[model samples]
Target: MAADRGARLGFGLAASVLAADVATKAAIVAWVEYGARHEWLPILNIVHVLNRGAAFSFLHDAGGWQRFFFIAIALAASVFLAILMRRPGSSQPERMAFGLILGGALANMFDRIGRGAVVDWIDFHWGAHHWPAFNVADIGITVGAALIVFHELFGRRRVSEVNG
Candidate 1:
């Protein structure tokens, strides 16, 4: 019963977060253009951009192979996440974290497959210092990763407790 509940909750959170992430990306595409920026604050801006590679724009400059490679990796990661979610004794936090990670990966992968690039827009800067432009899916991945790390570090059930 607990496992079933965890699966439902995890999948629900994944669906909502992924949908919001994708929808926001689509909105950025519709309302913003490449090389354009809308200053929301002195330190924050929304700039339309596309990435053809992985996190932090790794391999972003690759000619064409990056798309295939990234898509393959995202699909594999999503599959592995699904398998983990199905295993008995999966913790709720771990399941939720993995679901978010999988959803974010798949969302970005869909964009790469459909548009040949991942859409990015949110930007932050203070004078000359600037952070990398990112999007909703990236945010999900980062937050999910943090949650996973926290759960592993502090939320795990001890082996003795599990056996008892």
Candidate 2:
């Protein structure tokens, strides 16, 4: 990020990701019966399952305290992301990365607050092995994290070298 360029704003992309994530979750909850599983394809499934814990249902079976813990974490992370988004020297990709993270974090936080768990419905599997279910928020977070990593590796290095 050049001094003149400052930080790129990415509220629109973040908002769109949030909207799409919430909309899809709403549709899934409204139409799909809880615990229902549909094999959309040989390798994919559309199911309605509540995840009480983090990725892959870790700590899902814990009594119930994990809920508050996760909420706190997401809330803190969102605040930090907002700060990063406002930094003057942040680049476009960096801003987008933060935006995507913010959207997904808030979306999942909504679920954790409302339902005590996140709604996960996308499942991938082979004959006997099945991947854990995930949703749009998860996708956004995954991609956003990747983007941040990309910027840290190639983007920032190239910029520094060019300037020097």
Candidate 3:
């Protein structure tokens, strides 16, 4: 019963993340002109940009093979996360984290397959220094990773206490 509930929660969250990522990316593509930037706040900007590489545009200039490479990696990661979410004895938080990571990976993979690049629009900047633009999927992945780290460091103790 617990496993079923965990699976439901994890899958539901994954679907939500995927939907938001897709919708936001589509809206940005439809409404914003490519390469155009609009200031939304002192520290934020809305822009239409595509990333051809991994996080921080790593290897963005590495010709074209990186697209397929990244797609492969995303597929493998998504599969692994799905398996983790379904594993017996997994905690709710762990399931949720896996779901987030899976959703983000799948979202980015879809972008790579359909558009040949991932859409990145949210940009934060201060003076001349600017953070790389990213989308909803990146948020899911980043948060999920942090959650997993936090759980590993602190949450395991609580679980041990309850189960021991």
Which model scores highest in TM-score? 3
Model 3 lDDT tens row, 1-164? 89989988998888989999999999999999999999999999999999999999998889999999999999999888888888887899999999988889999999999999999999999987899999999999999999999999999999889989
Q: What is the TM-score of each candidate against the true structure?
A: 0.93, 0.92, 0.97
Query: Model 2's lDDT to the true fold?
Result: 0.87
State the lDDT at 13 in candidate 1: 68
Quote the lDDT for 100 in model 3: 89
Please give the CA lDDT of all the candidate structures: 0.86, 0.87, 0.94
Show the colliding residue pairs in model 1.
Answer: none
For model 1, the superposed segments whose C-alpha errors exceed 4 Å read 157-164
Off by over 4 Å in 3: none
Name the best candidate (by lDDT). 3
Q: lDDT score, residue 141, model 1?
A: 83
In terms of TM-score, which candidate is stronger, 1 or 3?
3
Q: Indicate the residue-level lDDT of 30 in model 2.
A: 96
Cα lDDT for residue 15, candidate 1: 80
Q: Is candidate 2 or candidate 3 better by lDDT?
A: 3
lDDT of 3 at 101: 85
TM-score of 1: 0.93
